[model samples]
Target: MTLLLTPVSLADRVEVITPGGNASLTPPAASTEPSDAAVETFPRTTAATGSGGTTYSPAEMDTQPGLQTMHFGAASLACKVASSTTDLVVINQSPEPLPAGTRIKWQLKKEGTRGFFAIIGELGGGESLVADDVLDGQAGKDDICIARVI
Candidate 1:
């Protein structure tokens, strides 16, 4: 016995064939564009003005210590600190939901003014992390460690 097969193309549908006969066609569902809220950007200050007539410009600030990019499951994250303080900030830019129990770890360097310090904190219900004294001193190059629990 001999078998022969013929291929057919439909305008916008997909078809399959079994030995019995041609299978029913079902077009794929259309995809929707992601919402603007799904996308997020890191927050950065061009310059900071504090009490005692102190001003720190981004250009003048030293390079952030242990700067690294991280992904928490489906969410994207970036970590950085000011040149002057122990305060560290992490930004989440993932489209999927990020619950309050996620955790992230990264090496940090405390430089500039405040001595190198290690920071560990947790993310709150509103998708923000709370810290005690993460970014607290002169801005320079110091290695630090930062971990966030989301």
Candidate 2:
């Protein structure tokens, strides 16, 4: 016996729009195999409201060892990671303020170990914050899954 399979064709270009910003994604060819790395995705129009008076969405999956952008509602986080160190720039464009008690937990996983960490960034209406060269020995170049709702 033999088996056969067919791959579906994808569009040449696709645009992902969230409250934070827009990202263009180009999918691989139909004949290509699925990638082992988890691709980062932007949240949709809907959002989850947290107890700290903030609305957020799940962020990106950092698979490679470089800079990646993660969008959470009106917050845009640009993270540059290398060797467990991260440089972050968070921006809030929503009309409502992000309270101080809000927490952004990041789930980090690598080849040998897996753990979680949290970071807090308070922002008023249309404000931004920058944290550079922050070290987290738990992070690695494998996967980082962020959750919604602060």
Candidate 3:
């Protein structure tokens, strides 16, 4: 099967689970102030004002066939599937490296399960992660993919 690398904005779907709870990771609109739910989720993230302002904010990530890429703050997680095995490609884009063992998970929701089940998945440790197997034949047409970085 062929998969197109279409960029989709996962504004409300992406989340980061922290010790406090699951916090929404969607970056706020530039024109408007960030809502309370749009707060930073990673603890090691830079909170100080920099040349560009607050350095940490969740941003939407993209995915393609056999691979999905997601981000939170300065961390990036890429989920790839090949030969029936899924592997997570983690890269720390931030200056400070993310601590090892940060929980990262990628899950493809089962088709027609109303978001209650996952058909295929893999786990890894990182600073951020996302899951959306667009051409994996396991996700529904209108499925909402959730990438969780704990």
Model 1 lDDT vs. the true structure?
A: 0.47
Q: How accurate is candidate 2 locally (lDDT)?
A: 0.47
Local error of candidate 1 at residue 106 (angstroms): 2.4
> Can you give the TM-score per candidate against the true fold?
0.30, 0.28, 0.24
Runs with alpha carbons beyond 4 Å of true place in candidate 1: 1-72, 82-84, 109-130, 135-150
lDDT per residue for candidate 3 within 1-150, as digits (tens), equals: 998898886665545678978644566666664455545556556566646654665666543223343344654434333222222223333444444444444444543221211323333334333323334444433343333344
Give the worst 10-residue stretch by lDDT in candidate 2. 108-117
- Candidate 2 residue-wise lDDT, 1-150, digit = tens: 899989998875545679876643665445565553444556555464555544555686646324333445665332323443564334555666666655443333342332222446556766655545443444554444332224
Q: What is the per-residue lDDT of model 1 for residues 1-150, given as tens digits with 9 covering 90 to 100? A: 999988985674435667888643443344584332333445564455555544444455435445554455555555556443555555554455455444455445444232232224443333544333655444444454444423
Score residue 73 of candidate 3 by CA lDDT: 60
Please give the clash total of every predicted structure, in order: 28, 0, 0
Off by over 4 Å in 3: 1-72, 86-96, 110-147
Task: Tell me the whole-model lDDT of each prediction, alpha carbons only.
Answer: 0.47, 0.47, 0.41
Which scores higher on TM-score, 1 or 2?
1
Ranking by TM-score: 1, 2, 3
